[model samples]
Target: MPQETNIPNKSILTPFNVVAGIIILAGLVITVLRFTKGLGAVTNLDDNNPWGIWIGFDLLCGVALAAGGYVTSAACYIFGLKRYHSAVRPAILTAFLGYALVVLALHYDVGRPWRLPYPIFLSPGTTSLLYEVGLCVFLYLAVLFIEYSPAALEWLGLKKVRNLIVRMTLVLTIFGVVLSTLHQSSLGALFMIAPSKLHPLWYSNYLPVYFFISSIFAGLSMVIFEGTLAHRFLHHKMDATHLRESEGVALGFSKAASFVMMGYLSVKLIGISVDNNWHLLFTGWGLWFLLELIGFVALPAFLYSLAVRERNLRWARWAAALSVLGVVLNRLNISVVAFNWYLPSAQRYVPSWMEIGTSIFIVTLGVVIYRFITTRMPIFYEHPDFRHDI
Candidate 1:
């Protein structure tokens, strides 16, 4: 005799599903409006302020937050931090999704999305920093894909392919680190040409150095942040190793981030002193800058230090969140808030509702995709078949 069992299907009408559906639908509408009516139809971008939150939030914040991939991989593969091995897959997945979304958001910002490949393939702008960013982003996105492919291959039961890709892990990590360094700094260098337009307090010759250094801690903080979220919602998806090592990863990253943030603060001070911008700090812009540095940067650094000293995971999580916000604030200050500072208030750029909605839509898409892949793939846990190999 044999018995048959039937399982009930999960409902698709849950709250998250409903909200995500609405966002996706709205995003489709905005996409149509953007392509049909042009950038003016969906954004507040103008000749004076061609860059808006799309560039500030989508590109700058996206890339900076995605630093977790290189940071985590470098720690594990290059720096030989074996305890962090459990974190590599999740970090790579986040970075891959983040960069993929950055490229997608660019389509909404650029006048000709199709021409994005033109600079890389057809006509390389060797003299332009933008071209360097484009090429690195393109290549680095490919590297992230390859770096993240092992999880997918494992899920598909492709052992040979996954192991082959695993063999190249060290080489890919090094190449990715180099590309990330170049583009992250190049992003800040792009604004150096507009020294007069950017506020005196924010502009400097060391802008590139500031950007690169901050990205290191930004990536570290993001790893902790992502781990916290994953622990909360995706707990069941993680295996014993991930759960066991998660705290260690958080604590170690917190210590590293704390030291790096202190270094970043010191360099920022040196930049001001070198540029002789001390007098500007007493003004309104200076106060705002101080808020960014002190409230966001210094406070988080201190919190991280305390977290590491006390071994408090909760404090580490909070510090990571604040540090992530600091990176976002710094990028927006440079690209949006501080750019065109001398312009009249009326002429300044303010994002339209549609622009904000589009950014939300893109982020929601990433969240949805991440949830889908992590649920199905070997991102949060080691596959039983390959446990010994890993």
Candidate 2:
């Protein structure tokens, strides 16, 4: 483990920080225009494209990226996989930031950002999958806050308080996992209600299960991907010993990701064949699905094997990144790209530059907050056995 020292203080004006600030400033300007001028002025959303780049990338991809928290928590605390333990704090921090930004992006995407909290108090529709999603998100945010409390306690110089929080953390960990499982799968269930809108190729009763499984693998892959990025760019801030130890975590993640990828690929094929979707193979959507499966799922699974054998964390990390891109594209295709396939290709409602810029801004904001929290807290440098450490 890394020594408990020299964690960098958060900076205000690194190049990436400056870029994020500028983009966010731009987004705030656009947000003002949105409230004043209407959604039409700042977005490419039509009745057909009610959900666009923001929903596709930030909401969908963001959830996949945030998969780290539940997956790691389950492995370490629930399943007793101690080898995966070090990844937990970082994963929780990643999930918290990712989901928080996703929630923000969602508020921006909705027709009435102001009435967003209505679901919590005024409108509770249990029949609707979105209602489940809303409630779970609200609860999970609290759960993540509790889960991450110990790190803050350590930074606050409150060893006794941190110990108390850590003792109670397992309950929060289990609750967070349960909430994540429900919402992650419920995201796919949101589409199941739109059977008429979704293409037959992508729509199925099993979508929730498929999405849930994919999310598990996606979470593991994301940790590997994020950890590698941290090592590359933030190594100067990381304890060298911590950096070396993290490689073992990376290797374990790759192995687990490959296994899950294989299972995912198998099930996807089984789903298609069971539904007799082979007949749709010649269509554009079919080809796109093939690319998603081969380019993202199978290719990454195969490469990780080589990466594991070669002992190359870089290759493993790259494959994880590729896998995440594939997962993002697949989700986007399901929500936007594939949903309106029957419409003419030219009028397919791609995102405007404004929407793209805002999407980038939201993710950048998530990354910045994640960096800020991890750097100042005891997350990366050490695990707190409060008594022993103090």
Best-fitting candidate, measured by lDDT?
Answer: 1
lDDT of 1 by residue, 1-390 (tens): 122222222366778888999999999999999999999989999999999999999999999999999999999999999999999999999999999999999998999999999999899989999999999999999999999999999999998999999999999999999999999999999999888899989999999999999999999999999999999999999999999999999999999999999999999999999999999999999999999999989999999999999999999999999999999999999999999999999999999999999999999999999999999999889999999575
Scored by Cα lDDT, where does model 2 land? 0.82
Worst 10 residues of 2 by lDDT: 1-10
All models, RMSD in angstroms: 2.7, 4.8
Q: Candidate 1 — worst ten consecutive residues by lDDT sum?
A: 1-10
Which residue runs of candidate 1 sit more than 4 Å off their true CA positions? 1-10
> How well is each residue in 148-232 modelled by candidate 2, as lDDT tens digits?
7777877888878777777876688789888988998898888997878788788877788878888988998999988988877
For every model shown, what is its TM-score relative to the native structure? 0.97, 0.92
In candidate 2, which residue pairs clash?
A: none
List the global CA lDDT of all models: 0.95, 0.82
- Residue 30 accuracy (lDDT) in model 2: 80
Candidate 2, residue 71: how far the Cα is off, in Å:
0.9
